[model samples]
Target: MSEPSAGDPGALAARLAALPDEQLLAVLVVATAGRDTLAPLYEAATRLLSETGQSGTAPGVIPGTDMPPGYGPSADLGSSSQVDSGIGAVVGDPAATGGTVGGYTAGGVPTFGSLRDKVERRIGTAFGARQLDRQTPAGRGTEEQWEAREQAARERLAQIRTSLHEGEGS
Candidate 1:
């Protein structure tokens, strides 16, 4: 019979079936390495291997040997039923994690803090705040004006904190 086209699934299956166990295993390894784009090849190799009763054993492994449970190819990794079915119940999910679908939290609202924030806050308190205070223009103003500005800043900070800690402790 003439060789079949590369895109022909039937021809591919027939060719794979004709391969010896070792060559078929090599094909399987190569197919597995390119799994994202070679799923069909991988499946064909796996099917051929299984048909020949050489499903899971890799090179150097003796066929029909007593292998430990779960170490064999027949072992179950996980079933779909074992997965969390709740909506937005996955890590980095926007709905569950309170972030945008693009994986970014809203501006000025910290989704989480790290050691960097603590270190920066400490440094700011120690020196940066004093430098900023000195550089800030001190215009003549009433006590009420100063209090209003301070209160506004405090409110803004509180709002940001509240946004960051929305679902905590519940």
Candidate 2:
């Protein structure tokens, strides 16, 4: 296919649509052209398929990725045991490790969470709402308020931990 003119979105779309899915992904790889960035994406795509018990080459893979040449087929991604589904799917599953504890994240790192909570926190801070800080308190918050907030947070956290631990026991 002939290259689309620099400013023509319609032509570019047409050209992209003409190729198969694999070819389209290959084009994307070339456009971005970076190994460090693409490797995780490639791994995730290929692992998603494998986790669902369908093994095939995922087209998003570039030259440095584990996927085979030309992104033909994924028969080479090793065994299913080798694939880690990152942090997303681990939230609710019993076997998922380092993802859930009393429905809170296993690790402090939360890749995704309730949008409302994020928005509320953002708005709260923006509106000059006092946040709980215990480690150091001179001008930020009074000792009483800090202690109260800290106690409340700990209580809530404990309840969640207890509930999660109970769930695991059953």
Candidate 3:
């Protein structure tokens, strides 16, 4: 289905709902963290680096929206000003995305990075919870490395869940 314009609240809601579960989970992660929360984003981004390609646009000229200019009563869904567009731009490297969100390029396998670092970043974010981009180690490794990293992400997830639960109890 065509995405609704930013001005169309009803349609917008539908689009949000239609987004795939991964994207929805990412959105929920952001919402739970509060857009203003830096730690969570960095922690999430770190985990994402291990589990998924960085969010980004296509390498070539971005394919235009299916609709022609001025085609509908509602404004073009992709033409709205940045602020009007509720979501931030995707930020994946063309090579990593194979020019799209689908997956990595041919022969390009995904890998995981520092579990120690992931844990540190997640825990750091938990403690600092309000700050952004504190300490996330960067580099490369195979899926084996990801075992620890994924574990760290899971642990961080637990911490976040606990914090939320504690806040609710109050």
TM-score of each: 0.25, 0.22, 0.21
Candidate 2 residue-wise lDDT, 50-90, digit = tens: 35543332223342345323122211212134345442333
Model 1 C-alpha lDDT per residue in residues 1-170, reported as the tens digit of each score: 87788999998999889977766664564445333576566546545655665533332334334544433343332323543333122212223333211112322132222223456569879797666655656532444578899999999999989988996857
Model 3: weakest 10-residue lDDT segment is 98-107
Each candidate's root-mean-square deviation in Å?
Answer: 20.2, 18.7, 26.2
Go through the candidates in order and give the clash count of each: 0, 1, 7
Name the top lDDT candidate.
Answer: 1
Candidates ranked, most accurate by lDDT first: 1, 2, 3
Models ranked on TM-score: 1, 2, 3
On the 0 to 100 scale, the lDDT of residue 80 in model 3 is 30
Model 2 whole-model lDDT (C-alpha atoms): 0.45
lDDT of each model, Cα atoms only?
Answer: 0.48, 0.45, 0.41
Please give the TM-score that candidate 1 achieves against the real structure: 0.25
Please list all clashing residue pairs in model 3, or write none if there are none: 38-132, 55-90, 55-91, 55-92, 56-90, 56-91, 56-92
Candidate 1, poorest ten consecutive residues by summed lDDT? 99-108
